[model samples]
Target: MADLASLQSGPLRDLPYRVAWRARGVHAGAHRGTSSGAGGLFRDLATLLEAPDPRRLDLRASLRDPFEQLYVRRFERSTAITIYALIDVSASMGFVGNMRKLEVAAAICAALSFSARRIGDRFGVIGCDREIVPELHLPAARARAGAVVAALRTFRPTRRGAGGLVDAAAQIAGRRKLVLLISDFQIAADELAAVFEALAAHDTVPIQLIDSAEAASLPRFGLLPLADLETGRRRLVVLRPSLHAAWQRERAEHEALLASLAARYARPPFRIVDRLDWDRLAAHLMEARG
Candidate 1:
């Protein structure tokens, strides 16, 4: 753990979002910022109200609205656990990892962020690759949603580039906060464990997001070559029945090792999110909240 973890929440709590009466042109002190108006120190004035379209009928609706829609939502002392979306944009998180894996990870972060804001819990963004992009460091805010969303849009994965995560994690420690680290878990197992060990004092949830291909047995084929996203390293290996079996074994071993370390590291739960099955992971997080 280097100086990266030294980051703090600072006066962010004091510069809370204030409610601006849009129609009356007055400030309603009852609540902080709404999605419609700007309300704090880190906040500039603007109406960032979300206008959902009727065309794109999404079933995530029922839950999304009750938890996310800002229509008449009120901010309360959440007591809902704080969450930090630590996305690993290392090169490996790019292309072959399926169509929108990075986007999926980002989407999850946004979803959680929206939920936190709704429930009055503070949520922050910590995008990590060679280093954490929120380099200067800022406290998370409900009205800062737009800025957070913008930061996530530019994320691109790179190789062996996460040279700063360990340090960054060390800087931000809080009471009853939850750190949701979503990455490919591309680093060495031992190194990964060491960082988690250092942050054991705070609640940290490690969500390792891998592609669908990485999670299952190989496809029926003649030959397949693979490239290492992180190191720009490449090697051509034939896809064979025996080779596939061996691959599964090795992968399983790695998974088991991580599980063991996580179980030992912190009482806070950790998870594995791949392209195929994240429903279980989602359910686990909700349960942890209870």
Candidate 2:
């Protein structure tokens, strides 16, 4: 378990994000939307009868009309959107090194919840491992951030697999949402592909949690005792410079594969290595085209 005091000391700041595609909904919000209403970006002009809004009548356009037709200035309405955090709570997420992976995930969720509510957007969370954990599920709502943080502080990842992610995806299938898929991504390649396929409809952003001590900071030569968090398997091996080099090469290859896979279904994965960088994450969210 992570030290709650340390996690609380450096609360993540609210991040800025934008959706490239036009949002679809009727509720008023901070993002650009498809609906035309009273106030927003000016879309186009329509005849008075078409829009039926006397308040929006364009006097100049009416005067220039050859047939003396009245025109109304139409504007696109800003709309609200749902933001969900789909968290992978598999045993690997419990790993603690330079930083606790699950603790970082929880902090992100807290920040997102606060930010979403600040902009009048609905926020929700789903924790999954072998199956959806009912206690860790929060339905989309305009809830207070304190509630979200409190709930996640008690979350413990003890399960083996991330198979429940597919099931969680199904539950939020109808409307398009800003889904933040937070995980260490330790699942098999085929399983990860399947999870991405399941969440293809939404605007998914992959947030990979990483700890340097996992692979990068090992001693050149030592007797290492390693354990698989998911499988509960243990091994003691002699670590050599050659072995370290091999491990790093394999890690790089896996990273490349993850990036390739993410580009196909979502934006490039935003990595939180050792610690989270708020500015980098905000920039990634704002600039991602996919």
Candidate 3:
């Protein structure tokens, strides 16, 4: 913990070490407490988001490292925008929480922030569930990213409060900037058209995290216990064939609703990412550079 506190407060020398921390989800808390888990590499990475806006690269610097600024000076145009990381920390997110979804989503956002920085776009962090956790604020500085990631890794979701996605979209600034909503997306967030219409004026993308059980529709043999990770509520529910079929039906409907929203909010040229392959999340990460 002492080392965790110190390293995040430094720069240059701490880069490699911090990267390891964030990559491995190392720090303090359920999602990040240091353990010999498989997520250690990303734990280190979760900690690397501590750069304060590479201040050396200003508008005049053409959003490049100083050397690159000199080479591409003429081609640089000003369309600087902002990218907001709108994450849901609702308890359902942690129902089976092992930090994989939360960790991956944070890494994706960190990666997005890195790419945004390259294009002269600013990054801001927002963690919400039924309500806003960290009041929305800009994190243009590199150092702020670690804080953002740290907060995210510790964010928890609940069962009762369901947030309004459209309302969250209105909290951001910059039309050029994109709002990324990352979640497991289990609950019905209302009518698809209404949700997309609310954010029609802005650029928004919803990233869903589906666990293996959810993907394969694991059998619910005998009496199964379902615990609400958010509310700490538990119930022994009987799983029947008909119930499983109904669940599958609802999941399909949920996906269709998501597709409809994406279709409505996007144009051919700037089409939103509609049901990206969870199995190939890495590919999406590499290709989603805007």
**Best of the candidates, lDDT:** 2
lDDT of 1 by residue, 1-290 (tens): 11111111122212122212211213232333323332232222111144343332334543456555433221221123345666677776775434345655555655666566765666777766777666423356554554555455555565466655666676676443566666667666766776677667655667776566655567655676777777788888777788878877877887777677667754334444444233565555644321
lDDT of 2 by residue, 97-167 (tens): 78777777788888888888889999999989989988778888888556655666667677799999999
In candidate 3, what are the lDDT values of residues 1-290, reduced to their tens digit? Answer: 11223223333121100011111222222122224333223222111123233322235434344543321111111234455766666666664322256655566565666555544445777776666665333444433375677666565555444364445666664344455667666655463355466656555666766555435654755687876665677898888888888888888888777776776673212211222233354343323322
RMSD of 1: 16.5
Which candidate should be chosen as best, given TM-score against the real structure? 2
Full-model lDDT, candidate 1: 0.54
In candidate 2, stretches whose alpha carbon ends up further than 4 angstroms from where it belongs are: 1-6, 10-12, 217-223, 238-249, 288-290
In terms of TM-score, how similar is model 1 to the real structure?
0.61
Instruction: Provide TM-scores for the models.
Output: 0.61, 0.90, 0.60
In model 3, the Cα lDDT at residue 106 comes to 60
- lDDT of the candidates, in the order given: 0.54, 0.85, 0.50
Q: What is the lDDT of residue 189 in candidate 1?
A: 72
RMSD of each: 16.5, 2.5, 15.3
Clashes of 1: 15
